[model samples]
Target: MRNFEVNGINCVNCANSIKNALSDEFGEIVVDLEKNPRVVSLNIDDKDLQKFTDELDDLGFKLIREI
Candidate 1:
């Protein structure tokens, strides 16, 4: 699994939105809104990270970094 800091995911709705959007393509996703910097943990490969970033970008969010 990889941990990513997400920007613009400010609430439960946002977290859910991301989870729903990503779940189909990237299985077993976890969104932790309570964490500092807001984290999204997933089992996606590095090559697919950019695709994930793009999907998040479309939803008005960003995968800021892997931590």
Candidate 2:
């Protein structure tokens, strides 16, 4: 699984919104959000990383980190 950290995610609604947006592009993917660090962890393919980043950027969220 691949990992990514997204910024501008403030609440559960934001988490769900990201999940929904990712689903449209990636189908069934896993997203784990930790409020303390304000990070979003994703379990996805490496090739889809750019797509995911672009999609999030289009949706107004910025990716702060990736692994």
Cα deviation at 1, candidate 1, in Å, is: 1.0
Clashing pairs in 1: none
Which digits, one per residue and each the tens of the lDDT, describe model 2 over residues 1-29?
55566777777887788888777667655
Model 2's number of clashes is: 0
Predicted structure 2, TM vs. truth: 0.71
lDDT per residue, candidate 1, 7-64, as tens digits?
A: 9988999988988888999998898978978999999888998999999999999778
Count clashing residue pairs per candidate. 0, 0
lDDT agreement of model 1 with the native: 0.89
Clashing pairs in model 2, backbone N/Cα/C closer than 3 A: none
Best by lDDT: 1
RMSD to the true structure for each prediction, in A, is 0.8, 2.2
Poorest 10 consecutive residues of model 2 by lDDT?
A: 28-37
Query: Where is model 1 poorest over a 10-residue stretch in terms of lDDT?
Result: 28-37
